[model samples]
Target: MADVQSLLDKGSNNGGCQFIGIWGMGGLGKTTFAKALFNKLRFTYEGSCFLTNVREKSKKHGLDALRKELVWSLLGDKESHIGNAIYPYTMSRLGRKKVFVVLDDVNDHEQIENLVGRHEFGSGSKILITTRDRQVFAGIKVVDIYVLEALNPNESFDLLSIKAFKNDYDDMKIRKLANELTQYADGNPLALKVLGSFLNGKNQEAWKSQLDKLQKLPCREVNDILRLSFEGLDEEEKNIVLHVACFFNYYYDAEDVKKLLDACGYSTEIGLTRLEDKALLDIDGGKICMHSLIKQMGKQIVREESLKYPTWCNIFWIFKKSSEILKKNMGSIEGMIMNLSEVEETRVIIKAFRSMPNLKFLRVYGNLNVQLRNKLNASGMMFLSRNLMLLDWVGCPLKTLPTTFKVENLVEINMRYSKLTKLWDGEQNLVNLSKINLSGSEDLIELPNFSKAIHLAEVDLICCRKLQNVHPSILSLHSLHCLLLIDCKALTSLTSNTHLKSLGKLSLAGCSGLSEFSVTSEKQLFLWVCDATINGELCSSSGHLSKINLVRLQRCEGVTSLHKLVDMRTLGSLDADYCNKLASNLCSKFDEMRALHFLRLTNCSELYEVPDNISLLASLRQLDLSGSNIETLPLSIKHLSSLRSLTLNGCKRLLSLPQLPPSISLLHVNDCLSLETLHLPLMTEDREGDEFSPEKFSLINCMKLDGQSIKAVEASVLLAINNNKAIYFWAKWNIREKELQSGSCIGLHSLS
Candidate 1:
């Protein structure tokens, strides 16, 4: 509501035709917001019209009729007959009138363009659009694209309470059930209302039973509305959505899932983007997130396919059903995942694969207890489907794969914490394999030859303690992007002969015995050599280091300086924390790192002062100098327009700080025993529009702050309050009564 009003106000000032798009998932109340906005602003315009369900209306009554109706609504005339040139006719009639128009539930760009021509409305006119497809607004001159988010927990509870109990029921048990239902709905307004209405007069036991049933089946009304988005997807997108709903919903990284899907011959990059744009799936914090109801809707789609012929389902995840299908040798099954954590004992027959020749994806995962591990056995397993594409088995019990198992079609093999001493006797056809993860395989001493796996993109061998050497074939993979070998204690050296053009990330952290490391991948973006014994010269000798964006050298005793990286223009993050052997003057050429955004030099005991030119990193956003030996920062730090966070905790040697930038939003000076002086920009009324106040200010254990410093802190708090921003201020000493005279100490509290 606030967003729409703000846009409308801005449009009023600009005096021009304005268009706004309200977009989100199906059940997020996009239409409700649009309706409220329309009603509130309609009285201010000369004419108003709301076209509801434009997508459905266009299909039912045709676009011509909707266009004619729009014209008649704004012109206040009922036209009997209108010609095919409705675009020009409607524009000519309505262009002189200031109006408020809304097109709700639009799904395609054609509907928008055909109904309302480009910028045809008069000056001071406002047009609002609500849609599930964000692509509908492409190429249109929209002033703002407001994405409506789901309700928060409190709002969801209040809405559900009003609908179910009419704000009268006060039973604690029923309220608890209502809270659980709201959580299960995942803040979706439509699901909350549906569940609330269904359980209006039901008893406690009925609510519990309904909740239990909802876990496996979504409400019919909610499912039908949400499934409209799913029904519009293409076949490949439908398959991808089902894959996430059944297997990878918030369980794995989106990149890993994308790799697997791409290997299955789907256009995953574009498909995932399109799904996200449609709001059926969300990629949050690098994980695929889907609403609870949407997930259940997708799973129900698959369940409906197996209603008559149980063996014809495309995928299975329930342990009982998957086990039954496997035992019955259901050849039509394409994928199955079995989690063994709930089972006490289970036995797999090795010959089951011979009957199910169509299996493409198979995964077995669980934290098997000691008794279950001993009882569960696959000792005689000898055959696997030749058409297998993905084989992910956590805690695999096999010592080696069966010799007859073909690897020609395998796309990914992930067997973490396995008991395998080796993968196979020799290399087989692996042309289609793209990823291999054998991390935590302590007993594994070597990797299989991957010379023919030309498409392999990632290989992870973290914590493979006994793995002494990497196969030479791995270095020749031209398509490899990530190679992680963290904590491989016995691994001594890694040398690459040819240039790996596609390699991007290489990590050798915790490899204590690593002495020699070299790579020729000029396109590498990240390199981690933390806690390793590799010589510093090896890093400096890499001619392609200039292209790397991040480099971690923590606890690297042999390193004395980063003078060698003076020319890395692309380096954005440099972490040299706890590098005790680092020289006081680590790197004097900070001006060369034009792209540096994060600089962490914490616990670098030998660092006495930061380079004066450090202020030249115009893109730097975070600077951490905690537990260092610096006494004072350069005054030029105030010139850093992009720095937002500064950490100076445990800097016992520091005596004072300089004026920080107005962009700084966080400042921490905890335990700074020698901190006697502090400098801050004075807050005044003239700087209202330009001020950027700190959201968090910490002064714990800084007892030496003088009276001037305390006053500055108080003024900063008042400024933040005036800006209507939440501020977290922590101080160990009691604030003076004079400082609280203006009520600036409302949110300030003592940490002591």
Candidate 2:
């Protein structure tokens, strides 16, 4: 349901500020949305960042590199961060000039922060981000959020008509076929667009048969249908994608995945060019993506081929062949790690690195206490002591690094899951570290000086229970992003007043004894941020609340109802599990919110009854009335026309249900079996609280209702009468405990 004519018109450049988000599910016009938005603003920008797949970029190029790329591009791809004297040099080059950036389908909170951030843009600057996650701009004030809901019935028909018959067919025949195709496409325009164009001149029965087959196939079976173009690939071109997936990093330069395949005697440079022409794959950053959907199909074919020929695959003996390439290229090796490697892969890997005597960085599948087997009387450290830049043994037990190496060139040493109980005892200017993950270091207490790693971008000390110091030295690395201290138990006061403007994802999930959060970063998500504090403290007045649980807020003494929460409309789900004092009456007032879908009000003990006006919410879909003292349903509950599921489980005191509207397609009433009376209406009774309204009720299940209670009943109702079942009898007696003197329910999980 969409109007394309108004889409570009609603995009804004008003008030010297513009916030545009291109939103949709995967493959449903997300990139198309970005391209459409770009055509609208092409004349306004001098430089543009057309970075595709923001998620894949960050995973490959570290976050700093991505940010620097943007800045560099704005200044004609020159210097990244200008020195104090050259700061004005870079700004003067870019100032008063508008640069439009389009980060296509960016999927992370941190990527958005790095891409645009809160710093005000210059007068003519506009930053546009396309994302599948609407919450990307949740906390920030977006000038316009163009939500790409599916096409309207007429629009869907028009789009397909243009694609299929292209104004050549009879109007009646075209409309009829388009309507049937629309039902299978389910309003997803991409599928409609693709299938419509493909099936245009086909016979009617052929189209119908395809739709019927599609309906039976599960989601996993949809890969080929989505990427049927890949099946035309010759055996040679088929191996290109398989070679890339197994070992290529995010930006898998075609030349790179090619070298591995070339070594395997499957050299297919001409074949690759042919596949790209067919659109089965595209060159992204000089690497192959095989198209997002096509890649899925290739993966399936690879899996099937792998199982059929166990020793070989799309690339013959991929791992063994890869080991040969790495071994042959070892003369120029700088650093490497092959942790947890299997025996078969290990031997091939060993042969590959055998030539790298000049290697500086190294780690592989071997016990920490074992000495080198080859170079007799030499320590493992001595074997690797030249020109090392970085060393990472992610989940290995390493007691020491190469002490004889020139440690002065060392920048980063990731011993995250290692057994190193002490920091490397070095006094050299450790100038280049930007990230260190000591997440599982059991005995680590303190860290190296901040003066050393002045460029650190992230530091993770998660699960280091003995962590007590806040590490004043951390103030030096002004560019840190992810500061994960999830299970640090002994942390009491977390204070950071540095230039932590770059920080994004912060998780403090299970730190029980921790109390105060003095950290000032761009964004933070607290899993449990309150105090069982030895001093009983609470969180800041209001942190950037995105997705949060109940413990994030301590005693609800100061908080009233959520009125300003309407601005947080991007919120999709909320869990207020233990907030025993919060009332459902206060929560129900959020009916004006159009995007609020999921509400979990599980343990609000004092939440005795749900408001009768809850049906006023046109957007309410998944409602969990579980674990409350709610006794009855209002006839007015039939107004919620969009609700697909109604869960009344564990609302133990619920004795009856409102004759639910037909919009409820999924019903979970396992705990509602105790309800003595389950009366469902056949039509809408929401307008007048008198009888069946006969407009909106399309309920699926109501075993305890009389034929009179269900007005306008259809004849196909299936009735069950088992030996132990007596619905009418229990329907009368289940209302006795409704007047019990129950205590106020605390920690209600209501997501109003």
Candidate 3:
């Protein structure tokens, strides 16, 4: 505690902006220290936020959700709408407010940028970052970087005694055993606690036996001490722990693990909880987050099962061992995950897979380079195991499945970006199949009859450029929930069946050859028809199908307008970027879209002026008009009370902009070479509502715009640029006379 307080004192004491980094190896209690400091300093700030398990949570739910959570935590606003670009909203809301924030377990620099960009927070704000890798702190100005050390012998003994015997150390025998255990722990607190608790209730003879084994094989490393905890787990719990370490720890979600284990007759609910209680795994934001040391210990246990017989282990993860086993034909493995994306290409015989008779789950991942280079000759081994259930091979370079392979018990097949023209030569009974994801299979030309796949729920064929025909039996599947045919350039037609009552989303974007479509179902929530040259009128013949929440029709060369959306009251997002042929006059009809929250018209080089009534979209949050030919914006834009982001990038011919609402926090006006006049609202106490300055302002490449126009807008912005020495603002700017023009003066859009 004294060490923590002493380090805190070394930070910037005047409440100026500062960043403190705490870095150390796994299990050194970096998170624990950060949490303690957060609790101690939280009350001193106007607002505070603590983001825990940032690395793990970013994988499961994505960084956008985390940004929303951060907004709610710091600003205490439950209804804050966070867009895809989250930094602007965070800066707009929290920039001027003194706050304390702690980002825990950050692994990537991109994560740091998206969460907390070049810190422009309030003067007294403090940001703390904690990570296992010291290199992650590079390029950031940190006031102090404290590396946590292992506990002392006495402290380790006390922690062990508390967890093991509830602090009751009066008995000499117990005290002696505890002291010996602490020494084996070697000042690592996690090892001491786990080992001490494993031998808590055992008799002295049992302790003696355990100690004898420990003496024979001394616990010299932290992972070795963690191995003892594994020894105490039952067979079922051990399997669960091993599975997590091998597979789930990397990317698999907890629900997927639960389903897989439950199918294997293991009580996954109880086993997972037991593992968590034993400190083998932790559940963060509903995902498995195992400590790095625990995962290492689990992998070590599997490798030790038979160092000479690695294939005898229940799971395989290491690329070297799996590759060696396959190359040397030394042994057969149970299940494996092979990712050769970042490695050099290597050719292997298909018989390598045939040797693994017990293989049930196999996942092969590759990059474009591997797909083009690696070869897997299957002429010698044409038969696949009948026990295979899940086969996911991304970037596979095969024309078809093995002739002898059967698909009776296959539950899922994901072969994205494969070079296959057909999945199979003949019809096969896919009785248990639930999903088929052949997305990005550019050369795929056909799909087998899915009539026998009664349980099939989804079929994705996105970007299958050569796929001209889809199986007619698809319309017969009543249980199908999603059918994604996005960018199937060669597909000319599709028939929508009314039996697909559960169909939720249908994407046909970029299918330039598609001219016919039939829609008979009404359950679709998302419809993306961008870049398609559809033959028929959209929703003109079909009765009003009104349940859609999103419609993307960008670059649909044949469609001139969204005249068919007269009844789509539920539409909230519309992205028509680069839709060259979209009629510009239809912008007047957008007033009917009162529920829209996001509207993007980027790169629509043909669209002219925006409709004056566009401000009728009262609930709109984001409005983008980048790369459009629009000449002027409606002055009524100030009436959009809910607008947060307004992008007018590349509006080369735009003459002027009207008074923008203070509700907007992000503005982009780059490359507007012809934009001569500007109007910025001045900040004053009389300004209507809570005013927020633009967190981000870009004016790059506007060659004809005068720099003095920006100076006259906000004088403080010049001071801010000079004070912070912002590197991003160093390009050429033509400075004009320093005089405030009459009505074109810049106002509250200052760079803070």
Candidate 4:
């Protein structure tokens, strides 16, 4: 506590704006110490606010909502600003007021920029940030930093005694037990507290028995405490933790795990939260994390089962014993993860899988160096269990799956880098299948019929270089949400008439051989950003696409027009940043999408002009026309009442811009070397439309601005900078006759 206070004083005692950072590993009491410091010093500042769960809340909601909550908490008001205006509003409201703020569990630097902006508050203000990853503060300016440490042996024992044996502290036997338990805890307070509570009411005999059981288990005290957390969990939660501990600890995403566990009839979200509460698991940076000790405990439990039945263990990690285990007909195995490269049983019996009747998950991966005849074969077991849910096999040598293999209950199949030309001989009734990945299967030529896969949500066939055709039945999936066929060079077309109403994302990038995108889904699909050869036409004219929020196309050749959007009304954003062949007048169709808020047409080298009536999109808030061939803004652009940000970077041909909109707050015009004129409207301090002025302005490398235009807009730039709006000016200009006479060229060119 004294160290923490001293660190805070090093930043706050000088009455200068300061930022302090606290970083350490998990279970090190970072949050506990920060909260204590917050309570101690919060009253000294004029206003204070502590933002909790910054990482989790930012994911569930966006940063904009968090910004609003911060503003409301600081100003004690009913309503504040919204959207891009929040930054300026926060800077204005907190500039002269001394403040104390603590942002807890922050994981991104952008969150800090959005919430705090800068340390420009009153002289006495101080901001504290706490996080588990020290790299979260890499680019931020912090005056002081502290790394919290774990407790010592005596400190650990005392903390445990208070929680476990509060009323009977003098008993000699219990004291000895406490000493022994602290050795296991190793200065971790969470483990000490949890273990102490578990032993609170037990008798000396019970304690002795528990200690004896621990001795039999090879794990030391920390693993035993983690095992206690596992013991408190229900059966479903236990399965979830064990699966994460064994296979999906840091590789698979949380959402993917949820999908797999959900297929296994477990309430995954609730179970994960319960495990986190018990300190057995943590979700950090959107990935699952578990301590090494906790994970070892889970593996130990499975090995104990191996001790009981060495041949039919529920988990198999020994590859040399495969032949003996299979020949003995051990059938209790539920999970198997094997690497074929290290196996010494080369000519094992072909009936191994048949003995394991309860297998649910199987993953086999490794480089098999043996010849075809020397490999351990499985021809005798023609059929797999119907209860199997996940099958991930790499470098499979068979030309097709076994003829009698049952796949009715399978939920996921990943055969990446396999040698199979086809999954099966024909379509099977795969009703429960949700995900299928066959990437890098160069010999795969076609897909099986998916009409019966009603639950299918995602399909990935990326880089299947030899894939030539897709089964038309895949187009009819009603529950499909994502479909990826990137780099399937030989694939030519999709079903022209089908309804994929639930599909939201479709990717066909690098499908150079494909010349058509003829699917016709309903109007319910919302977002589509894909690279497909459309033969110089946009979406199918006959199909009705709903109001999509975003559509991005890159490097798609022979795409000349978007006339298909003439009837759509709810298009929100359109991006064709590098479509070099696109040379049409897109503004002619812009009027049809009145709800469009963002439009990006950067680097479209052939785009020589924009329509004069482009300002018809009253809802446009951001317009990016960088790296294009346009020479000047359309006169009608002044009518964009809601436009707030206009980025025209690298517009080499642009010579001038019309009067910017009154709602504009950001203008980026860097690298416009041909620009010579810029027009600025007078700004006032009123709430009406005429009082609006940009808070952020950049003019780096705009070399050709005339001296007269620079003189004309210099006052507005100075006014905005004086108001603390952060205006920057960089212009290449020759000395005017009057300026040369006064010798003021150096002072007039640069503004900081």
**Local distance difference test values of all predictions, in order:** 0.78, 0.53, 0.68, 0.69
- What is the C-alpha lDDT profile of model 2 across 133-225, one tens digit per residue? 555666555545666656777777777777887856675754676687776565566766777787788777767776675543323433534
- Compared with the true structure, model 1 gives a TM-score of 0.69
- Which candidate order results from sorting by TM-score in descending order? 1, 4, 3, 2
Question: Which candidate has the top score in TM-score?
Answer: 1
How displaced is residue 73 in candidate 1, in Å? Answer: 8.8
TM-score of 3: 0.57
- Residues 282-346, candidate 3: write the lDDT tens digits: 66677887764566567566656535565556665434344456544434454555555533434
lDDT of 4 by residue, 18-37 (tens): 77878654455667788998
Ranking by lDDT: 1, 4, 3, 2
> What is the clash tally of candidate 2?
26
**lDDT over C-alpha atoms for residue 440 of model 3:** 92
For candidate 1, list the clashing residue pairs, or say none. none
The number of clashing residue pairs in each candidate reads 0, 26, 3, 0
Candidate achieving higher lDDT, 1 or 4: 1
